[model samples]
Target: MSRAGRLGVGIIGAGKVGPVIGAALAGAGHALTGITAGVDEERVQAILPGIPVLDALEVVRRSELVVVAVPRDELPGLVTGLAEVGAWQPGQLVLHTDASFGTGVLAPAAASGAIPLAVHPAIAFTGTSMDLRQLSNAYAAVTAPAAVLPIAQALAVELGCEPVVIAESDRLAYAEAIAISTEFSRSIVAQAAELLRGAGVPHPGSYLSALVHSTVDHALSQAGSAGAGPPAEALEG
Candidate 1:
């Protein structure tokens, strides 16, 4: 596809990540051809009101850019299944949002002439419009071959993310680090909220939300200034 043109995009999953990212790409002028969601139809529709909801094969056949946002474990099977059915088209762009596996997992589709890309946004998604604003400050870990790296980066930028190239060999370790930090942060916030509620504070979670946001923003700013150095304290348990 030409750099100036918008591709016809289809989403293979309508879970938390898919609809939001599909919406972001739609906002970037891409035509949202269809989306597939087995259980979260209502939530998906709420996130992508006018987009058509179709089956996975139909989605793949109709789109120039197919985004596979299923869970990490299901990704490889889905890609291979699609390839086996000859769903992937020549010069098609295939992207996945899973942080654990890079484009290597999309080898089945790539062998069929699809351009595989792994572009993961390093932010928690709420499957709501609120997530859109979060995209501006979020960083996306992008893994693609050198020849198509610019295309991945461009898509990330269009979605309001700063794209960082992640080596395929380092993808799993990178995902683990993100999981450790984000999951631990959530646990800490939940514990704090529980303690506040025990002390007779109503809406403890609501009260703690702003403080957590501010603290995280400050920490990220500090980390950026420190040039990606390891944190003084380990977050992992």
Candidate 2:
């Protein structure tokens, strides 16, 4: 912790998620120590201007809380490789934002006595300040050792999300639900836009935007109603 209870937060992976996480933490009064450079430097700077671009080791060395927002596939190797280099500091808070993983993926860091946490925000990030607004409506799935569970939940709340406790054993199922919702919405929208374009619509995206939003809103409302579930009968062609 820094002066007056503020943590020195460092972020690895300057991709879509990292900078946004840094920004959110900064908004919550945590000072950003620095962020790793290499991905989208422009977006990183835009989201967190004036924060130094440091190497991963230096970032780890300086931070009291480290945020790892790298891609799902790269997370294990990054944690393990950092462990190999002896980078994890004892007693430091280490959190990753990958839905597919729980703290088990951070065993290497935990072995060095670092506290491991998984707090995956449920949102499709645009890698911009716009995401900050969306965070208020988001739910973060938090998993951590029972002793440190409150820390994870508090951090998630600080990031403007409601915290939902997900057991480490259930991470895969939680991840599948997130992926399915995101991909299905994206695919349906793209297909609709393409069909409109083929039919000579000048701006299919603009044309469908309101309709899509209202339709989805209606469907969600229905799903939330008493005794609601999937339709019993299939639609006729």
Candidate 3:
């Protein structure tokens, strides 16, 4: 799909990442047709006011661009099911936000003539507008066919992200790197908080939160100045 003009977009999942990215794309001038409501209608409306909440398949049918932001493991099945039901439109754009898999996971939709794209933002989402700020400085891992690669990059840039093309062969490694940096860092912080609690420290979480924030900021600053990646200790600390 050539992003020559604003497109009608639909979100397949109402989870944390979906609404935020939908909102970001909306902010970038795309029209949000609808988003899947399920049991989270209230939550979805709260996050994305003015967008209609519709059934998953209905959303896909109405959209020129469909964003599949479901859990990673559910993506392939969802794409297959949609394709089986004859839901995908020819020349429509289908994007998945899974870091672990590249555009190949959307093969079913691709077979139906939907352009497949894998666009994974590197930053952790808080399911709020605050995440928009992080996106301005974050890198997004994008994978798509060469013909539509520019469209994928343009979409990432619209969401305030710098696009980094991740090869299909390196998808798992890229996903693992993000997991270690964000998830493992949280685990380390949790352990430190527990030790602080054992030592009878008052408000250990609050103190550690401030310390960690400063440490991360300093590490990022150092990495920027040094023109290199932060050391593992700096990242974990």
Candidate 4:
């Protein structure tokens, strides 16, 4: 599907993930009708004005698509509660950002007979409005039933992201990989910044960022070589 007829999405949590991504999706042509919130009033009000703010159940009832972007520990209960409230309509798309598991975590909603899909962006979030722009090119992992693979993939494309299909069983592994990647980046940057400080650099963040860019490039290049041969040789290259 092209960008023109983007789907209307209802976000059930306006905390860190929902409001930001919903705003970005709205910018990308998807109709973001309403957002649900339980966070700081001043914060939520500042970010999402004019748009209808509803209770979580009301959000699930009003929209064709439901996005559960709440905290990990809270997801199961929130989803179960939504199911209990008879909120999901059949064929309504229920999506989540929980990467640690695939659509399997959505079994409850699915049993409610809703079309369950899970979308997870690979980029780290800063929980800022500016971060909305970054969604334009970030990567997303998608898991959905085969019948509506296109819809799920199209949702990722709607955000201007390349969609990677994560197998139902592999979602946890992919999430763990993201955690590793982030921690490794932090550790390496920390060490590099310390070395730069030793060198009396006035501003180390820029240098550290550049170094990270180069390192990531080199690693990706090495990875592209199926015949990269040996770890030592690839590193030396």
Candidate 5:
């Protein structure tokens, strides 16, 4: 719908992922009509100063594109509550960042005329001021109804991500794949830290992070090559 002119975006869960992505999208020019947070006023102000933190219902009532950034386990309950209240609007697009579930779980909202979308980012959110700095190279797995796929795609791109479309039915499987990758990297990082600890290397995390990034960059460059790029060009590069 002509990009919706920076969507009057409202975030229902101003928790870790919610505020971070909301802030990032706001930085990307979306009009963040504040956010919904159950936290006390002091705590809410600590995150986003001078921004009006409304109640969940109010967040939905105000925005044309409402993003439910609550944890995956909380999604069904949250959305169900919103659906029961008739708070969702017909033209409002409902998108969530849970990797394990799809729009099927949000069928109630869809039935209520909101476009349900599963647009999970591939990166973990720390819910801090640093979030905006970490948004580069973010990737997302998006599953949406055919009619609303463009909406999902546009939002993902706005987040500076390479969005990969997957079937809604396969969301859980894709989540598993991501789980394995994240765990593998995390496990390796843990082991590397231990090894460095034993070797008496100070601030091992810095070295370990750099090593991982270099390896990944080299591997990505190698993969980008079509033919005979002199195998293991990474080490040479």
Candidate 6:
């Protein structure tokens, strides 16, 4: 970490989420030391142009903050494997972006004196620059040891996101909610688009885009209000 509090950040994956996140942190003045390309060389170049592509262990060894943005299944093994190799450094901040887990999966790294954190940005990623813009509108679910909880929240803020504290125990519930919403919305959109196409609409997705956005926005705006939805009669019709 620099005296200015900007970290030398390294990323473990260059998949859909990693490079975009590195770009976000870079935007906040953190130095992106390196990233693992993982077959996403094109994406890494596109989003984080000029960042060095290094292996996972090299990335961890080189940085004060390491961001692990691999798939959920891969995270535990990767962290443990890194620990087994003695790659984790004392006082280093190690964070993973998987919504399904909190800091628990990072126990191995923590054992090596690493400070573990979990910060999941609540949005679908396209592995593109558009994700950087979306970060401003998204909330990040942050889980970390209470002593360093603010660090996790600050990192989320640095990514242009509002930070919401999520308890370690509730990480799975949070993941479930995210999964349900995204899957349901995607299924609905696909069905709607199919129906529209069947009805001879030339561009079903484009036609429904505005309507879907407005409807979801309205629903979310009304989400916190009790009895805020349509009346029984409205549903019946």
Tens digit per residue, CA lDDT, model 5, 4-101: 57788888887778877777677678887868765554545565667778888898888888888887788999899888999888878899988998
Q: Which residue pairs come into collision in candidate 3?
A: none
Off by over 4 Å in 4: 2-6, 38-49, 194-202, 227-237
Poorest 10 consecutive residues by lDDT, candidate 2:
228-237
Q: What is the C-alpha RMSD of each candidate to the true structure, in Å?
A: 4.5, 6.1, 4.6, 5.6, 5.7, 6.2
The lDDT values for all models are 0.89, 0.90, 0.87, 0.77, 0.78, 0.91
TM-score of each: 0.90, 0.92, 0.90, 0.84, 0.83, 0.93
Rank the candidate models, highest lDDT first: 6, 2, 1, 3, 5, 4
lDDT tens string, model 2, 1-237? 223678999999898899999999999999999999955788789989999999999999999999999988999999999999999989999999999999999999999999999999999998999999999998788999999988898899889988888888999998999899899999999999999999999999999999999999898787757444322121100
Clashing pairs in 1: none
Pairing residues by index, what is the TM-score of model 2? 0.92
Predicted structure with the largest lDDT when compared to the true one:
6
Query: Model 3, residue 119: displacement in angstroms?
Result: 0.5
lDDT of 3: 0.87
Candidate 1 residue spans exceeding 4 A from truth: 1-3, 229-237
Residue-level lDDT for 220 in candidate 5: 60
Instruction: Determine which window of 10 residues in candidate 6 has minimal summed lDDT.
Output: 228-237
List candidate 2 segments past 4 Å from native: 1-3, 226-237
Candidate 4, residues 1-237, lDDT tens digits: the string is: 555666778988777778777776777777877887666656655666567888888788778888889888888888888788787788788989877867887888899888888888877776677666677767788888889877888787776677778778887788888889888888878888889899999789887777679988898688768653234223212
Model 1: how far residue 203 lies from native, Å: 2.9
Q: For candidate 3, lDDT tens digit of each residue in 99-211?
A: 99999999999999999999998888877888889899888888899899888888988888888887788899989988888888899899999999999998889979889
Candidate 4's error at 183, in angstroms? Answer: 1.9
